[model samples]
Target: MNNTTQNKPINGNSLIEIGYPENEILGIALKINKKRTGFTKAEMLDKYAQVMSSPQDFTEDKIFKSLAEAFINGIHLPKIDEEIIPLNENPKEFKIYGIEKIEDGALNQMKIAMQLPVTVAGALMPDAHQGYGLPIGGVLATKNAIIPYGVGVDIGCRMALSIYDLPASHYFEHHDILKETLMKNTKFGAGHGFHGKYKAEHHVLDDSKFETNSFINNLKDKAWSQLGSSGGGNHFVEFGLIDFKEDDKKLNIKKGSYLALLTHSGSRGFGATIAGHYTKIAKDICKLPYNAKNLAYLDLDSEAGQEYWLAMNLAGEYASACHEIIHQKITKELGAEVLAKIENHHNFAWKEIYNNEEVIVHRKGATPASKDVMGIIPGSMTAPGFLVRGNGEENSINSASHGAGRQMSRTQAIKSLSQNKINDYLNDFGITLIGSGKDEAPMAYKDIHEVMNAQQDLVDVVATFTPKMVRMADDGSKED
Candidate 1:
């Protein structure tokens, strides 16, 4: 016996070289290796030859019976088909607003998303920027499938505005008191929450849905702790001034400038946990190509999908609760009366009617601009945010930009911008900054005016709110 042949063990490759079908190679090699563990490669080869020569003799043998029968009958093992959902050959046509201002990467992401077999329609807003799965400011409508990434990690992240009856000059008249109230009343940054006397209360924590699943049940305590707290990364609690150039019937306020409180936050740790858990389940069940894996979706009829839907809605409600509590607390502290309130969730999913058919609409970093719907679109810390009324444009899937959108990446902003420059902008705009990093500098965002101009058909600006005092997480946290 040759030494090389004696030492070399039989493997699938060797079986393939011996004219065995690719599908049967694994079974044949495994059977040979298990039944003849101590036998050398030469002995194995000899046995294989014997089996091929007189396959009937080994028909009764447990391990060799199938191998012999397969050889005698010249039959190949059945191949298991991989369950892969391919991209649509003919992708649905999607609309893009402000194409010139949008980066190519974001536009490319939108194009790729439109190619999804589940995707029915999509639209890219003026604020579109590169993000995971769907780009920020990307609105996608799908048929009976929900993509977790499309809803974003910070599920139900939204903007809340409370306009007070006091004049805009009230912010400056009591700047010190107002700034102190924001710092003391709000909690920012990750994992930072109110304790003891500061812990807030909300009715969302009492919902029976929290008891439905172990995953959600465990989040109740965390939700309670962070009930009225604001999370980091573009989340802020600010004192601002809202100017209504003309009388607005919706708010019923006279034409004038009024003091207001604006907040940006979400369900905090609760929503994040739900998103992470369900996104993993979606990826496991929904097998897709490498490029589209992140966009994996869960069938709405499946158990997992139902659970996610419930959990997502609960998180959205919890987020709204956080804002409500924050407003209640601050209003009580300041002894100010709220004249009007406007709020909307950007990162969420809604079952809406499009083309006379029901579809799940996922707005990732985008706002629902359905007809007469009220939403907020914030600018940079120094720029002015807007209160807008939706026009319900069918081409945009009734959506608009969520914010001015990042003109530069956080890393790029940190590398290119300086604290001195940020200070100059704030000073020039008569804005006071409490705690924030250079990454959130005003220069890092697109011009809000230009963004609004580009989406004239999508929404109508009702009023403008200019930040007077801004407070963000001191810790450099990533945007939700």
Candidate 2:
């Protein structure tokens, strides 16, 4: 008898060679391997061949039924030209703050998004800029639908600030030590993470959602590897001086300049994977016009929609854990105690009641400025950032700008700016730069003061943070 067990196992490549389409390869290969675990390579190939030859005969076989059906009917993939759903003839009206500052491209995108059948209401923030589907600072509310692109790829991207008991003078005295501490404790750039003894741990890795589906399950290892690490492209960790004009009872600290730590990051590779997977699924299911395809949404009651929701929230929790670990590690290293901490995230969706009806509100790159909510809005590396409280402006969807939005694209900044220009700006502010590209030069972003001024009705400035030393992803890496 032939020893078929010695032959190589049938795999995705093998299926492709036998005329099986690319899209159906994964599902078919997985099912065959899983259901016929004990079968030899020869036996596996013979079974598949038998099913392909007489698919109708195997309709009653539980293991081969789906495969036979698939063979009978060709697999269908989404086509870009197809319009499964038509655009709304009358787009809903949306409020725009600081219209003079926003680019026409961004405004047009917001208009297109409002035309989606699922959209109920929308808003454009003062710092708005053109993004993939919705503008960067766009807030869109949909009825029983969730738009993946409206939430952006960097899910739960946010800011965190920690106030220490040390005086601002401490930064002047131990500037070198502080810089070294940041370099040693933090890992920047895409795919960069701690290894061996330095690897970070967090309870988010234990979340049951990781086991929810094959796609998410495959990402658990990546989440574990990148835990506590900050990814690049506008993301940074800095030592700063915080000045509170007045004593705040909520923070339990007196008004004065104090040493603080501020970090900007998100869920790293974990969120990117989740977004890519679900966004594709959303696009395939809810086809729209070529211009509005990115705004494709998933009905909340569907299984795919539920999976995306779970994955999105898990990313949010993971992002918070990353900030916690960063603060904990650096403070432990310096032997300092944190007196007050504040954090908030954007690029997320929320279920909120609007006009007595529930809707899914997506804030792509806007902060939730609901009444009395606290959030941080950072400027460029050389500019001062602000701490603010929300005013709950209903017309603007209770949101505020996330940052001094980029005035120039990364390519434009790199081509137009120079290292000398970046150095001069940092010198003027007495700020030290560790590792950053010209793409993130201070001049690349809009004036933070102007952005804040434009949204006076949306938020109240509570404090200001001046950067002392900053670290970002080095050159040649994309932002997260």
lDDT of 2 by residue, 1-480 (tens): 135632456676545432344577347755766767555553454355435433444555667778877755644344656757889987899999888889998899999999998898999998898877788999999999998778877789989999999999999999889988998889887656655677788888899998889878877876887899887778999999999999988878898999999999998877876775677678778888767866879999999899999999999999999999999989988888888899999989999988789999999989999999999999988899998999999989889999999888766787789889789878998989989898789998998989998999999988899988999988434543
- In terms of TM-score, the best-performing candidate is 2
Per-residue lDDT of 1-480 in model 1, one digit per residue for the tens?
246755666776555433244566347656666766555563454345334423443565555677877655645422246477789876678898888889988887788889898899999999998876788899999999999888877889999999998998888789999988997788787655666777877778889889878877977876887788887668999999999999998789999999999999888867776775677677668877656766889999999999999999999999999999889989998998899999999889999999999999999999999999999999988889999999999999999999999888766777788888788878999888888888788898999999999999999989999988999988754446
What TM-score do all the candidates reach, one by one?
Answer: 0.83, 0.84
Evaluated at residue 11, the lDDT of candidate 1 is 77
The whole-model lDDT of each prediction reads 0.82, 0.82
What clash count goes with each model?
0, 1
* Candidate 2 Cα outliers beyond 4 Å, as residue runs: 1-83
Q: Residue 166, candidate 1: how far off, in angstroms?
A: 0.2
The C-alpha stretches of model 1 lying farther than 4 A from their native spots are: 1-82
